[model samples]
Target chain A: MAIESIDQTSSHLKLSNPDSTTLVIHLTDDWRTTSHLAAFENVCQGLETMPSLNKVLFDASGLTGWDSKLLTFVLKVRGWCDDRKVDLALEGLPGGVQRLLHLALAVPERQGARKDAERQPFFPRVGEKALQVYASAGEMLAFLGSACVAFGQLLKGKASFRRSDLMLFVQESGVQAFGIVSLVSILVGLIFAFIGAIQLKTFGAQIYVADLVGIAMVRVMGAVMAGIIMAGRTGANYAAQLGTMQVNEEIDALQTLGISPMEFLVLPRMMALILMMPLLCVYADIMGILGGLIVGVTMLDLNPVVYLNETKASFNMTNLWIGLIYSAMFGVIIALSGCLRGIQCGRSASAVGDATTSAVVTGIVSIIIATAILTVIFSILNV
Target chain B: MNEAEPQIVVKDLDMGYGSFILIRNLNFIVNKGDIFIIMGGSGCGKSTLLKLLVGLKEPLSGQVFYDGTSFWEAGPEEQKRIMRRFGILYQSGALWSSMTLAENVAIPLEQYTSMTRAEIQDLVSLKLALVGLAGFEDFYPSEISGGMRKRAGLARAMALDPDILFFDEPSAGLDPVSARLLDDLILELRDSLGTTFVVVTHELGSIFAIGNNSVYLDVQTRTMTASGDPNRLLAESKDPTVRAFLTRGAEGK
Candidate 1:
C-alpha cells in the first residue's frame, strides 16, 4: 500500500489517498474563527474525486491552532459523510474539538421543530391578514361589551375597584396633561389665525381673521388638537401600563382573586378620560381664542378689544356644543382603543410596544371617523 | 478535596434598595468550575445578589473580585473586559421578543468577533444545536415553549464561549421533566467546558442535583446564614434556619 499526496492546492488544507477506498484530509495552519480557513466545499470536492471512498480520516499533524471554525468545517464534512454512510474518524482531531462535537450532536433535533420560512402566495397572505383583522374586530367587540357591563355596574354602585385608583387615573390623564394640551391648542390657533390673515388681508378683509379663527377653534380645531394630544399621551400610557400588567400576569391575578380587570383597570381609565375630555376641550377652546387674539392684535393690526368682541359675536352655543360632543366621543374612542389593545396584548416585551402604537393609531382613526359621522348628523339635523 | 483557585470572591457585600437592607455583610467564594448555588426563601434577595455578582447593580459597600481584579473598582474599560467573559441567563429567558432565535444568538458573536457572516451563522447553529434547539433557528421567543425559551437563552449566553455563566431561577416555570433536563444540561456544560456557574434558585431539586457549593441568604436576619457544599450543610450545619431550609421546614416541625 502506498500513501500518495494528491492535492496541496489550498495552503490551509491538503488531500491524500492512503488506499483507493480511503481519503485523508490534511488540515494545516491556524483555523481560528477570526482567521481565514479553507471552505467546506474543498473537502467535498476532494471527496468527489475519490469514487470508492468508504472512510474519511483527518491528518492534523500540520495544524498549528484551531477554534470553532475548524469544528464547523468538520461537522459539515461529518454531515456529508453521514448522508453517504461513510466512516468519519474523529480520533485525529484535537480533544477539545472532539468533546464539543460530541456535545453538539448529543441531542437529536425534535421532529417538526424548525419553522421553515415559507412565503405564502399572495392570495393566501391576503386571506390570512383578513382573518387576523376579523379576529381582532371580534376581540374589540367583546372588550367593548365588557366595558359596557362595567359601566352598568358602576351606575348601580356595585363595581369592584379602588376609589384611589380612579382618583389617581383622573389626576394623571387630566391635571398632568394640561401643559401639553395648552401648548398644542395655542399653536394650532395661532397657525389658523396666520393662514386666515394671509388670505383675508389680500382682499382687505383682515378683520375676518377673527371670525375664521373663532369659528374654526370653537367648532372643531380645539377639540381635535386636544383629542390628538390625549391619544398620543394618555392613550399610549394606558396601553403600556395595562400591557405590562398583562405580561406580568397581574390581570390573571385579579381574575384569580375574583376581581374583574375591566372594573379594576379599564373602568378607572375610561371614567377619568371621559370626565376630563370635555373640561380639557373647553380649556383648549379658551387657549385657542387667546392665541388667535395674539395674532389678531399683532399680525392683523386689530385692537384687542375689537378682536375679543368679534370672537364673542362670532361664537354661538351650537359650535360650542358640537365641540364638546366631539371631545366626549373622542374620549370614549381613545380610552376604549387603548384599554382594548392593552388587554389583548400578547405576553412579550415587543407586544407591549406594539400595543402602545396600535392604541394611538386606533384612537386617532376612530376620532376622525366619529367626527365625520357627527358632522354629517349635525348638518342633516340643521343644528 | 483539592481547592481550586477562587473565580469570584465577594467580601462584606451590602445589597439593598434605599434604607431597607435586604441582605448585608454577605461574603462567599466560588471556585473555578464550581456550580455555585445561591438559595434562600422568597424575598431573601437571591436575585439581587445575582445582580450584584453580574455587575447589574453596585454593592452598597463592599467589593466583588473576579480573578483578583475588583469589579466595582475597575475602570470602565477594565470592567467591560471582565464583563465580556460572563454569560447571564435571566429568569423567563428574556429573549428579545422581536428577534428570531438565530438573530438573538448571533448578536453577541457579531458584536465581539471578527468572524465572517457565514462563520457567525455556523456558530449560531452549533450553539443552538448544543442546547437541543438545532432546527428552531427561525422561531421567535414568543413562539417557543417556556422550557425551550430557557434553552435558547442558554444558547445565546454561550455564544461568546464565556468562562462564567449566571442563571437566575433556571427552573422557575418549567415542568418536572424539563427542569430535570435543564439540570442535566447545566451539569454537562460545567463538566465538559469547565465553565463556572452561579445560579440563583430555591428549588430543592436543583440545589441538591447540581450544586457543589452554595450560599443561603436569611430573610429574617438579612444576611448569609450558611455557605459551603449544600449536601454537607444539610448534614452538619448547626443553624436551625439552615436546617429548616434544606429540609423544607420538616426539621423545624
Candidate 2:
C-alpha cells in the first residue's frame, strides 16, 4: 500500500495515500490558522508526485478545530486536484464547513471579471485633468450665455419656468441667506474697526475707526464677505440639490418631457441670486456701519453721533454703486458655478458630493478674482 | 429550524411616514423558510412596508415581531441586537462606492464578529462566489454592470449568514436571463440553507417563480386587497384589480 509513504503532523494535518487511485488525507484535531499552512502546502506538493492519483477523499472525522485557514487550504487542494482532472470529495467535514466550501467553489471565476487599466504618465494625467477643466469652463460659459438669453426672454414676458419655483429660489437665495450674511458682515466690520482703532490710536485719531470701517465695508468688505457666505451656503445647496436630481435621472426625465433645464432650473436660481445680491449688500452696508458704530462707541468711548457723522462723511455714491455692482457680478458667478457643476454631475451619489464641493470652491475662487479686478478698476477710476 | 414556529409576524400593522397612512390594518406571518412576498403596483408603499418591517421606518400603528421578540417595543440596544440577525438587499445595491466589493461584504463581518483579516477575506471571496461574483473581489460598484451589482448586493446581504433575508425589487432593471439567475439563486439558497425570505417586488415572473406566500397591495384601495398563493389567486380570485395585477393586465386564457 502507498500508505507507507505518509506525511504526518501530530497536531495538524496528515496525508495517508492508501493506494494509487485514492489519497486519503487525515486532517488532525487542530486546523486553525495558528497551525500555519506549510502542512497543507505539503499535501499540494505531494499530489504533484502522485501521477497515478485519480481521487482525493478528505476524511475530516477527527478534526476538532476549523476556521478560514482550513478552508483556504482545502480550496487550494481542490484546485490542484481539478488541474489533474481528479475527483475530490469531503467525506466527513462539518455540515457548515462543507456547505461553505461548496459555496466558495460553486461558481468559477467569471471571464473578464476585473478591468485593469494601464496607468498613465504624470504629465498625461495632469494634461487630461487640465483639458477636462477647460472643457468644463466652456460648458459653464455656454450655460451662462443661455441664462442671459432666458433673462432677456423674462424681460419680454416670455420665459416659461414656474413662477413659484422662482419665488422659492428668491426665498432660498435672499431671505434664507440673511442670517449668515448679517453674521459675517457684522464680524468683518467689527474686525475692521478694531484693526483701524489700533493704528488710529497712535495718532490720537480713534474716531477715524468709524470712517475706515464704513468706507471698507461699503466699498468691498461687506459684499465680499456676504458673497463668500452665499457661495458656501446657497451655492453649494443648489449644486447638491440638482446633482441629486441628476443622480435620480430627474433631469433626464425633464428633458424627455420637453423641458429646457436652463430655463426651468438655472435661470431662476441665477436671477434670484442676481436680484437679491444688491438688496443683501444694502442690508450688509447698514449692518456693517452699525457694527463699526458699536466698536467706536464702546471700545473708543466716542459719542454715537460723532461715529455716525464720520460714517456718513466716508460714504460716496460712486463707491457704493461699484460695491453693489461687484456683489451682483459675484452672485452671477456663484449661481453659474453651482448650477453648471450640478447639470454636468456624473450619475452617482459620490458624483453629487463632488459637484457640491467643486461648486463651493469655484464660487469662492471666482469671487476673489472678481474682487481683485473690481478693486483695480475702481482705483483707476479714482473712486 | 422549527417548522411550527413562525420566524416573523406582523400584527394589525399600519405603515406610513408621519400622518400619511399608506397601508393599515395589516396582518401576516412568515413561517420558517417561506418565500413571503409583498407585491403591488407602483407607489403602493410596498417598499415602505419593507422599511417598517426592517426598522428603517416606524409603523404608524401595530407591531412587528421577530421570533417572539417585538421589534418596535424593544429597547434601542435590544432592537439593534434583533436587527443584526437581518440582512437586507436594497433596491439600488447600496454598496459603498468608495470600497472594493470584497471590502463591502467584509464590513458586516468586521462590525459584528472578531474575525481576523484573512478570515474575513476568505468569507468575502466565498460570499462573492456564492452570487457568481467570484473574481470581482477588488472591483468597485461603478465598474460592474447593473445585473452584477444586484447579485453583489445579494452577496453582501448574505455575508452575515443571517436567518432572514430581505430583498427589494432584486430583478428590477435586470435583463431576463440575469433576473432568472437571481431567482434561481434565491431558490437555491432557500432550499439548501432553509433561510427565510421577505421580498418586495411587482415582477410577475419573479413572483410565480419564487413566491410561495404573497400579499397583493392594491394602489386604488391603498390596502392589502388580496393575500395567498399568486397562481391560485390568478385562477380563483374575482377581484379585477388582483386578477389584472396577477396576469399583468393580459386577458386570461
Candidate 3:
C-alpha cells in the first residue's frame, strides 16, 4: 500500500493514505436498514485493503441510520484494531449514539464538541415523565372504567365463571370477615354507650344509651368499620393474587390470546365483594345494636322492651340508606385500588409483594378518607 | 421460482433495551422450507434477535422482510395477517398455565379462525395428535412433563398451520434424550410440512443434525463470524473462533 489522496467526507473521518500511520473509515451508508451483513461485509472488505495501519479514525457522518447490526460491526472492527494494537478514534457521533456506544462497547471518551452541549435530565425528560404522570392518573381512572366494563363482559367469555372462584371470594371476604366485624362493631357500640351513659347520667338521662348506639350503628359506624377491615383484607388479597399472575406473564399470555385479564381476573372479585360488602355491613349493624342493648340493660338499668322500643323509634330509613351508600362507595374504592395495583405491578415476585402492601395501604387510606367525607355530608344533610 | 424469495429476511437489525445494545446489524434470510439456526454463545443476543424477527420488540433501526415485503411497511391489519402465517415456540414453551392443553391449542384457532366450539375442539385434538399428545387434552401444563409441555407448545404453535415457525432454544433445559426427541420432532415437522424454521440455539447436536444453514455470533467481537451450511463451514472455515467453537466438543470426545 502506498500514499493515496486524503479526502474529507466530513469533520468526523477524513479518508487518508493507506500507507499513513492513521486511516479513517466513515460508515455513511444505509447499514441499519439495508442488508445488515452485506453492509458489515462492506466495511470489513474496505478495511482489508489496508495491510499496514497503526491508527484509524471512524466517522459516522453519513450513517443516517444504524442498529444493533451496525453496532456489532463497529465493535468487531474495534476488536480487530485492538488485536493489532491500533488506536481507533471515533468522532461526530450524536450524544445519544455516543452514550449507547459507550454503554454497549464499554468504552468512554470525551471531546470538546460534546462537553458543552446541554442534554436533558434522564428522569425529567418530557417523554417518560409525561408518561409517568399520565400512567399513574390513567391507571387509577382506568381501573374504575375498565373494571365496570369488564364486570359486564365477564359472563360473555368462553370460560364461564367457575363457581369455585366466586365461592372462594365469598368465603374469604364474607365468612372469614364475619367474626372480626362483629367483634369490632360490638366494641365500638359498647364504647359509644359507655360514653353516652356517663354524659347522660350528668343530666339524669342515662337511658339514652339505647338512642345513641342505635342511631350511630345504623347511620355510619357499623358500615364504615366493616368497609375498612374488608379494604385491608380482601383488597390486599386481590392485589397479591393478580399481581403474582401478572409477574409470571399470565396476564400477558391472556392478552396474546385475546382474553382481557381484567375480565378474567378482576371482574369476578370486584362484583363478588361489591355485592357482598353491604350485606356484611348490615350484619355488623345488627351485632353492634346487640352490644348497645347489653350496655343499656346493664349500665342504665333500662328494661329490654324499653331499650328495643327506643332503638326502633330512633333508627330512621335515611340513616340505614346512608350506611348502605357509604359501604358501596368504600367497596368501589377498595376494588379499584386493588385491581389497579395488580395490573400495574412490575415484572418480579417482589413486585407482587409490593403491590399487595400498596393495595392494603391505598385501600385503607381511601376508605378512611371516603368515610370521613361521607360522614360530614350525612351530618350536613341530617341523614 | 426466484431464489431471492425468502420466507423471512432480517436486514440490518438493531435491537436493545433502550441504550444497551443486545444485537446489532443482524441480517439473515430463511428461504422457503429452509431450516435456519442462529447460533451464539450465551447472552450473545440470540433471544433478542428472535424477538425482533417476531415483532415482539421494535428494532432500534433496520427492517425485516417476509416474502420480500417489508415487515414494518405493513399496516396493523396487514401485519396481523402476516403474523397468521407464522408461529412461535418461546424458550419456556410459554404455555398458559391456567388453561388445559386442549384450550391452549385452541387459542389461535378460536382467535384467528371463526371456528365453532365443536370445530375448534376437533382442530385442537388433531393438533395434539400430531404432537403425540392426543389423550392429554384435559391436563394443565403443571401436571404434564417438560417434554409434554414443549410438545403442547408446538401443537399450539402449529394450530393455524402457519407456513413458518420460529423456536427460541427448543432443547434448552431438556435431558439429552428428551432434547433429541424434540429435535427429531422438529425434523419431522420440517419434513412433513416443508415449513421454514428459524431457531436460535448453540446446541451442537441440533446444529449438526437439522441446520440446513446457520449464522454464528462471535461473543468477543459481537458480530457474525460465519454463515452457511454448518457442515461445510466446519470443514472449510478459516476463522479461528469458528473452528475453536465447532471443534471444542469433538476434542472432548
Residues A1-383, candidate 1, lDDT per residue (tens digit)?
68787764488888888899998888888988888777788668778888888999988998999988898899999999999999999999888889999999986774545898899999999999999999989988899999999999999998867676789889998999899988988888899999999899999998888889889988898889889999999999999988987785445434422347798789999999999999899999999988998999988899999998989899999999999999988999999999999988998999999999999999999988888999899999998
Q: Interface root mean square deviation of every model, in Å? A: 15.0, 15.1, 3.7
User: Residue-wise lDDT of candidate 3 within B2-91, one digit each (tens)?
Assistant: 363577888887778888766677777778878888887776788778767776668888899988778888886667667768778877
lDDT of 3 at A306: 90
Instruction: Score chain B of each candidate by TM-score.
Output: 0.97, 0.96, 0.92
DockQ of each: 0.02, 0.02, 0.13
Q: Between which residue pairs do clashes occur in model 2? A: none
Which residue pairs does candidate 3 place in steric collision? Answer: A68-B14, A68-B24, A68-B25, A69-B24, A69-B25, A70-B25
Candidate 2 lDDT, B1-253, residue by residue in tens: 4544688998999887778777888888888888898998888899888877777678888989999999889996777677777878877776655458997787678666889989999999999998889999999988998788878878988988888899999999899988999899889888898888999999899999998888988776778888877778888888888887888778531
Q: lDDT score, residue A43, model 1?
A: 69
Q: Rank the candidates by lDDT, best first.
A: 1, 2, 3
Per-residue error (Å), model 2, residue A72: 4.5
> In candidate 1 chain A, what residue range of length 10 has the lowest lDDT sum?
A249-258
Candidate 3 docking class: incorrect
Instruction: Give candidate 1's fnat, 2 decimals.
Output: 0.00
| Residue A16 Cα positional deviation in candidate 2, in Å, after optimal superposition | 5.2
Writing each residue's lDDT as its tens digit, candidate 3 over A84-198 gives: 7888775655466667778875534423326656778877688878888897887688677867677666656544344556777777888888888888888888888898989
lDDT of 1 by residue, B100-138 (tens): 999878767765789998999999999999888999999
Candidate 2 vs candidate 3: the DockQ winner is 3
